[model samples]
Target: MTKYFLQKTLSQSVSVSGTGVHSGKQTHLTIHPAPENHGIKFRRIDLPGTQDIPALFKRVVDTSLATVLGANGAIVSTIEHLMASFAGLGIDNAMVEVDDYEIPIMDGSAGIFTQSITNAGIMEQTAPKHFLIVKKPIKIVDNDKYVMVYPEPCFKITCKIDFQHPLIGEQELTFDRAKNNFEKDISHARTFGFIKDIELLKKFSLGKGGSLDNAIIIDKDRILNEEGLRYPDEFVRHKLLDSLGDFSLLGMPIQGHIITRKSGHTLNHLFIESFLKNKNAWETGPTKME
Candidate 1:
């Protein structure tokens, strides 16, 4: 199965323009094909630096509001959605150029990035893609939240989320990348937060660009958005989507079954760090894609 895959990247350059979620500044992003082993990197053309930040778990310097990668004194924040798009599409190497410190949270979902990349076309390279084969179970716990990964034949996730809101209670979502379409099942699901949270976030200068157009805002027992929801169980689906993106920080595709319960970006980062610390739990080499 491992021999069947070759490294892949975009066939041509593609770009998008939007407003940064945190910076609240208009931004532009461009993607270009990179060498076989180049992997995914973010270049801050707006910043005075030459070191490109690598999209890897070790480079993660912060996971509070979003997954942030820092290297060479430069940092790129809010990259989970784009990273998930690359992982779902099996893109191996690409140079992502951003004209800002943060990525534009387009619609607060991976759908836009996924569709734009598809339009740019995907091209395979000569090198076989590498994957992290899970050999044993790895888990992380944060208060009542827990995330665990077990050995499996392919990439899959079983996620459970709970919210105090009426619209969102206890919800569970199970997804297999091989059987389920990432774009259809998870990519379009937008990020969500509470109305109270938006006010509190603004006090601390977070989610500056967040609005009903980008995020699903829930106020008490009602949704603030006029257009209901894309999926009835979109809340859990978005969590699953986030988990997929966070797990991609391992720097390669993963072959395992992930079971998570109310885990967020911080916990996801901790789990990845734990898995990498245990040298015998995973092996990186040529692995087949679903």
Candidate 2:
């Protein structure tokens, strides 16, 4: 198979250590190259004998605060960023080992993971790559929010967010994998939250490790980060970044155009479930590389 159409894994093991955004505890994650067809799986090294958790839609257990995967009573929380990093770079198989239940929220963006993986390099495997090619439009609507996907020759995303806040009223981004660079266009756009919601998140056992250092914090009129926004539309870009990671749970790349409006982890998961159940909407197989 052509290298571009073949599966890929990391060329060497890579590791990162930091604090969990929700747990507020230090955690270490290591990504190791895996054989073809192994797919991306996470092992909780902290809990020996627990079954490995596959990074697929069926494995997701929670999306309240972050995308969480669980199996055999073990879990790995806050995995979207790392999963997005792998998807953005076209990695198909790898073994992710973590010493904590949650993956560290490095800089609150996929930049750290993307850069580390890029620096270590990706290795092409013997097996051909597979893609979930959209055959017909599939849509999921929740009151005013929605997620939809249409047939496209290559992957593309259009995300729109409207918080109705004074600082961030509305933002939109259209990212085509054919032309956009993930690291430059989307990876650096950090996850953001409003100061007003911190207490609510804490009551849910989340956001305990958040700080200006890892995320963009907003007040009524301004962003509290010493350095300002990475892009004027970083909010929308980060939303697109999240959708990219959430969609990766399909267990393969996609050949489609995905559009989202005010979507979040929960909505994304709902859409995935609907998409899977409506099997006629998509087909799985190798796709030609352009």
Candidate 3:
């Protein structure tokens, strides 16, 4: 049988500071190496008398604006994007220590995390890396929205989003995990939102930490940011990036082809749940490297 259970790796202790999209509060996050099989755990230094939160799908408390995970009365908010970066980089284990409930929305992209992890370097231990590979077609659909995963030897994703705005029309992005360059292709893609949501998000105190520096804000006719789009299809690219991060919450790398359409965190979580429920549809194995 192929070897399974790849050894876990973690970043050398490094810190990242930024503002939270929802809390609008400045936050500090430190990444520290953890022992094998520890997976990814979050510790909130801001709260008192609460236990650490495991970054697991079952603990996910909210997915409306972002993916939030809670456990033992403590919560970690807005984690999908960073978690995706770790997943894409094949980081199997680490401990995240933060001084706030929400992870800092660094540039609203995974580039910062990617850079930090690369700087910290990856260490392969005695154990092997584990992956959940799809064995059969499994699908989840909500009304007209849907996401599906099919058996594959490596991770792959195709995302299609249609905003129909003049600035961002329909766009699609695809990446084969084995062939794609995570840092060059996916890391810099920033999260995006419509101009129409700005007021609503502000009223809810959500975008207090958002700015052109962190996100691509588009009005009805054009992008408000003077910098223009990072890529011609950046809107969908960001969605694919977010999906990668959200899918990473599965607690292991996935070997499969995922197709998503107009889905966000909510649908992402639902898809995870569906996959978990149909455990027979997939099996855990070691990730194959080229």
Candidate topping lDDT:
2
lDDT of every predicted structure (CA atoms): 0.89, 0.92, 0.85
Q: How close is candidate 1 to the true structure, as a TM-score?
A: 0.96
Give me the overall lDDT of model 3. 0.85
**TM-score rank order:** 2, 1, 3
Off by over 4 Å in 2: 1-4, 203-205
For residues 174-207, write the lDDT of model 2, one tens digit per residue: 9898899998999988999998898788888878
Pick the winner on TM-score between candidates 2 and 3. 2
Clashes of each: 0, 0, 7
Candidate 3 residue lDDT tens string, 33-134: 888888988898888667878888888998878888998778899998788878878787888999988898888888999899889888877777788888
TM-score of 2: 0.97
lDDT of 1 by residue, 85-150 (tens): 998888989999998888899998899999999999999999898888899998888889999989
For candidate 3, the per-residue lDDT at 218 reads: 81
lDDT, candidate 1, residue 156?
88
Candidate order (lDDT): 2, 1, 3
